[model samples]
Target chain A: MPEKVEITPESAVRAVLRDILGLDAEQVAGFDADTELFGALPELDSMAVAGLLTELEDRLDIMIEDDEVDGELFETFGNLVAFAETKAEE
Target chain B: MMLRLEEHNIGAILPDLPGTNESMQPQHAMDLDKWASALLSFSEQAENPTHVASFRGGSLVDHKIELPHWRLSPVKGRSLLRTMMRTRIAADKESGLSTSMSDLMETAHRDVLNLAGNLLNPEMIKQLDSAQPFEFSDTRTVRLESEAKEADAIVNGGPFWLRAEPSDDMDLVTAISNDLIDWVNG
Candidate 1:
């Protein structure tokens, strides 16, 4: 049987920021692991958050419950990546 | 006595609004007001509304609804409706209201197209509406074509192109397409 492939949260976050937010390569490249996201990035507004979560669910094939969303998960790039990773593993 | 409805109240009112599937016209403001009032009353009676009804704004204004988070101008009808729709979906999410698959698909379609118009060139956006085959991305090719369907069909059986790659993450692609369309349309 072929080994199951897994999507890393880092790649997912980068892809979502680049693809969904339309952030250019340079802008996305600037997002370090610790870079703050939710409030820090103007592109990641409320609507953008919804779109991101939905996209993440679709790409990672993970279900994110409404209650699972909170500020800490989006506090920084690392935080979001960790959250996605956890969800993907589950 | 004036009544005030907050953003959450507006959220509750949306699902109950008549003709939600149709685009709202400017002339329907009065009808919207009536629907809002009735919805508010029903919500109050249910005692489970997200927002409290209050007397404020003025005597004629029975429901002083406010969506502070939206920051929408009262003058713009289209903007108001859009904001309301967005807010309603968000609120429904919080309230655990199950959205139908068709409704979700429609919302996704609109959002994707809007984003596509934003990120892509006008030529690209226009091309998407045509029957000619073209590349949408490095991985996806699209072409529009017509199809015959039953009158009451829920799915839009054609006139829209299907992405060529079956194994690709279509949702992510659709999300990316939204930015392009949004740029073009805006």
Candidate 2:
């Protein structure tokens, strides 16, 4: 098994949002993990969605199954990071 | 003291991009000239113009079908015209090399067909230009016109290009193509 992840969740969260979401500072800061992701940013279309998933795979080194995604995981910034955390835990 | 979100550069946001040919034996002098002309413009200068010129469709147009020419963006048109002029200049210099109108056409076509890599399909752009009228609006697709009955199927030859990356699926391509065709025909 891999070692536990000790980095600040907040910073990890920030990195994902910045690179994966392609969110600018304002867009990044505007939403916390809990804020709504869908319908909030008009730019977060299917292409953006796919791009973010790829980034998450690269940065976190976690595999997200296609079937694992639904309306919920993408609901808010918080939910996405929480899922990432779970992957780290696993 | 704060950095604005809108101010951030996308190049800074993503990883860097890396860069992209050969000779073909042709039957006639004109064929060879066309091939050389295309290679010069495509490989050397004004790659984008050569792409836009495909919209003009010389030989491919002769076989594929035709659409009433719409004004492409001024930028593309001007750049294409400029590329043509440069090809003429280069042709004048080289004794063995030459270019023809047909060569210009082929290069333009290949440049465009390449968009399939990371984007939506153009469908049968040349054939669908004659679509009677269509009306559509969708995020992923548009509808062009058609004379075919039922209006259920998306025949090729519409006058649009897929400008963005799309998911890899037949259903998605068909849907988007249909939507754009419907919209254009409208």
Candidate 3:
């Protein structure tokens, strides 16, 4: 039997962004703590955001209630990753 | 995908299921059973041995094919429905109309619903919400390495289906082609 690979919340967040926004590895890797997301990235529109949240929930195996999602959570790369990390712990 | 399959002398026929793509049927009038029957009928017309390869929501209906199935990251119908619903809600919010999941579901139950871009009826929504891939002995399930779902094989690839625009990933395509060849010939 193969060992299960552990997925970190930060990595999960990165993957969701890549998949949902169609960004390449280099582009996502370029994002730093302060890199803005929602408004800064034009591709991260409302439709994409819905898909992004679903992908994040699927990858992290965490349920995100509708109320938990706000514009602030997607304000920056750090905030999104931090939210994922918090969700993973709970 | 067709080119790769052709290299292995495997002919492929991508049919338009009822109410989808080029099909003349109305989307709002189609249900799971109708789609499944369409697949079954299509398979019957093939002269050679056929293998079903389904992706995402297609898995729910591919079970009716009665052939050895190869599924790539097959998803439950409810998950697909939820994504569409979420997309609809997000679109509505963008237009200054606040909508909830319950609101959408209620409308779907009562009348035809325009979700994301597709028009679906109540019965279609009801069936999709509870549909699951059938468990069969001849099935081989494949999932992306990022996914934690139980699968017969795991492959490395990004979820291109979720991308905002149509994009090509040859490495991912080649990997899938190779795996599918092995599955078919093995």
Candidate 4:
């Protein structure tokens, strides 16, 4: 059996991005607070963002209201992680 | 999955539910009960089905007939509908047409709305909003290791279906097939 590791919001965000974008593990691991996401990555289009947000909600057990989503929230990796952290806490 | 099961001297068959995948029926006219009844008839025509193995949305139909069932990563219909709705909203935004989930749902109620490429009618959408896989004594549920939901067993793998593009995960396939084989022989 795989050992149970506590899933942090940041880790969950990274994993969701990797899974939805079909990126390599190393590529996702390379992401940091400064990494640009929405405009930087071609795969992070509107449709992909929808999938990404839903996957994040599923993985983190958080509900992200539609009104809560904005371009600023997806501007950078750090921004997305912060949003997920806040939602997870609520 | 069928090939692996055959290697173990077990026969397997995957029947496409009516109103989808080359079926003559219109998808907009079908709902959960219709799919369930169609699956029942299809299985009845088969020589003999030892057990029913359903994945995701398929689990919603597997409960109509009495049989030992194995579900892998089964999800609530509302979850699937929500993702599709979000995709629809995104697509509309790309086309310069701003739409919200409530707008899409209101349209769905009055007319057949194509959500994420699926043509869903009012009844279909309404049924999906509350559909859940029925639990019974002979049912076995499996989930990916990353999920928080309870499961009879867990396997390590990503949600391949959620990927932007189609991909293969042989390890996941092997793991699920092994579990099904064990359950069949256990």
Best candidate, lDDT-wise? 4
Task: Tell me the TM-score of each prediction against the true structure.
Answer: 0.36, 0.33, 0.92, 0.93
- After superposition, candidate 4 runs with Cα above 4 Å error: A1-6
Summarize candidate 2's per-residue lDDT along A1-90 as a digit string, tens digits.
111233444545555555444455566767775788778767665445554554455345465654576778878888887888887677
TM-score of 4: 0.93
Span of ten consecutive residues with least summed lDDT in model 2 chain B: B12-21
Q: How do the residues B86-182 of candidate 3 rate in per-residue lDDT, one tens digit apiece? A: 8998988988998988888989999999988889999989999999889788798887876756778788888789988888889889888888989
Q: How accurate locally is residue A47 in candidate 4, as Cα lDDT from 0 to 100?
A: 84
**lDDT tens digits, residues B13-93, model 1?**
333343234536222233334545655565556644443221111112223332111110011222222332334455555
Q: For candidate 4, give the lDDT of residue B33.
A: 86
As a whole number from 0 to 100, the lDDT of residue B90 in candidate 4 is 90
* Candidate closer to the true structure by TM-score (higher is better), 2 or 3: 3
RMSD of 1: 21.3
Q: Candidate 2, residues B27-89: lDDT per residue as tens digits?
A: 211221243244444434432221111112221221111222221111122222323333342
| Model 3 residue B132 CA deviation in Å | 2.1
Q: Tens digits of per-residue lDDT for model 1 on A18-52?
A: 65565665788788878988777776665666656
